[model samples]
Target: MTRGGREKDRDDPERKCIATGESQPKAGLIRFCLGPDDQVVPDILGRLPGRGIYVSADRAQIDKAAKKGLFARAARQPVKVPDGLSDLVERLVTQRVIDLISMARKAGDAVMGYEKVKDWLTKGSAATLIQASDGSERGKTKLHPPEGNGGFIGVLTAGELGLAFGRERAIHAALAAGGLRTRVVEEAAKLAGLRGHLPTRAGGHDGGVTAMKDT
Candidate 1:
């Protein structure tokens, strides 16, 4: 059986953001580790070999950490913050989310196109609904997210979603409940933060959708 809605794993551990000074689950933060030359490198996959310093996923927080030398402070040594680090993290996170969705598709846990997605949603086989941020608003609004929080993703462009589904372009898709689906939600949220605004089920911080819920 599928798990309930939401992405964060209770046992996954947590970290503190150097810029915000806020402690939260690791899913909502970005990890950075020092390179051989003591340069700060974003461990987008959290696999680098060094003690990790974390910052919130928001672009502003990352910029603050860079501009204020917070990463150096967190690392307790001088470190080089790469130029356009925010853009780097955003690109990595976007790729990560896309990769997760691709894996889900290969696993038969994801499907694209309006009818397939609608079928999956109505049948409760879909735990999450995904629509392209560039899709027609009228078309996107015809489908609601599955019945749960964290069940909607509307940040990716049609071209990006197409890459995951092996199509030229795709406007809508759905993810079946599983760890991959959850990972997609978690990473996509981080990507959304860095994007400053994204499209959710009912819309996103770019405009509407208060608290990330459809209400």
Candidate 2:
């Protein structure tokens, strides 16, 4: 972790992204390994054995790396990049973020539904606020985010947030201070950067009533 208590920097170990000639922290980059058939497989957890190729988490960076044969150059061997590599990576990262949130919820460090979220916020137990990207703007505006640069995440969709809470859908949620909260913010930040939009905080009802959409 960094001195301020953030997760370790991805570039700290100096991994090179195939797209950009520059090397950076591994946490901000995605790892890939050449499979038996020479296919490039994403190593989301960075635990895959083998010399790994790295790419920045941004969609454009991944696309350029694949299109320009940068993976082969980095790996020093021919590597087969599947079609839609960016989409695949995005899906994997999104799933990972959702899974982390789900774990937090299961551990009693997370709460969904407007009232529960408000209770946490009112009690000063909420460390971060999460709202769906596609949720109604007027509905999201009702809740104020915690006071801090990293206190709000507005990337995941209602359906995605629902996955985290094990519900049909969710528009609002809050995470209590804990290890899982930190992980969620880190992963969600990456997702937000890749997806290219900040979550909306525009609308909601008194008592945390959120209008969830099916987008």
Candidate 3:
């Protein structure tokens, strides 16, 4: 299972996490590569050249790898790990997710606003539901995500969603079934793992979801 607790596809390529020493889908691990100066560089997009070293998406795992000489061991050379490596990965992954959502919006595969999202959900066109983590609990409860484990994303703030939709703030959004949806969910799962936990749903009728913030 992925960090998001979703089943992994058997066909997905797997990599060993230097932190956990466990094999998982490449998407569930953050890739790192050795730079010219032997610095450990995060391959968030998995496009950096050279041999890739992997760590689980969790922030603690990344920190463990950095503190335990795991990266150097994997590279078989001395490697410089930057200060706040987990923070760097979080920022990059968060941006990647936001950028993908923006691309989905431009492609007409994503929509924002309660009415539009609700319409898509009602019509069975929405593949995923997105809500701001800090949005009002009552407002968010009016809508539920599609029927699936990764169908809901409440990890992003209203301000973050605003950036994706080109607005000041966005409370609700939905993604249609497409390649973008898959990418968005996959990346969001990584973000969730890094953050430790996510707001899966409301606790009750009025209670809000609580995030397990990273220390």
What are the models' TM-scores?
0.89, 0.86, 0.91
Ranking by lDDT: 3, 1, 2
Local error of candidate 3 at 94, Å? 0.4
**Hey, what RMSD does candidate 2 come out at?**
4.8
Q: Encode model 2's per-residue lDDT on 101-208: one tens digit a residue.
A: 999988999888877778888899998988876677766777778876457877787778999887888888998886688777767766764675443354222333
Mind giving the per-residue lDDT tens digits that candidate 1 earns over 1-215? 11112455667587888998877788788999999998888898888898999998889999999999999898898899899999999999889988999999999999998888889989999998988776767777888897776778878877778889887778889999875987898888888888987445744234432221110
User: Between the candidate structures 1 and 3, which one is better when assessed by TM-score?
Assistant: 3
lDDT winner among the candidates? 3
Error of 1 at 74 (Å): 0.8
TM match of model 1 to true structure:
0.89
lDDT of 3 by residue, 1-215 (tens): 58734679898788999988899898788999988999999998899899999999999999999999999899898999999999999999999989999999999999999889999999999989998876777788899899876789887877778789998778889999875888888888898888777548752222354322211
Which runs of model 3 end up more than 4 angstroms from their true locations?
Answer: 4-6, 203-215
RMSD of 1: 5.5
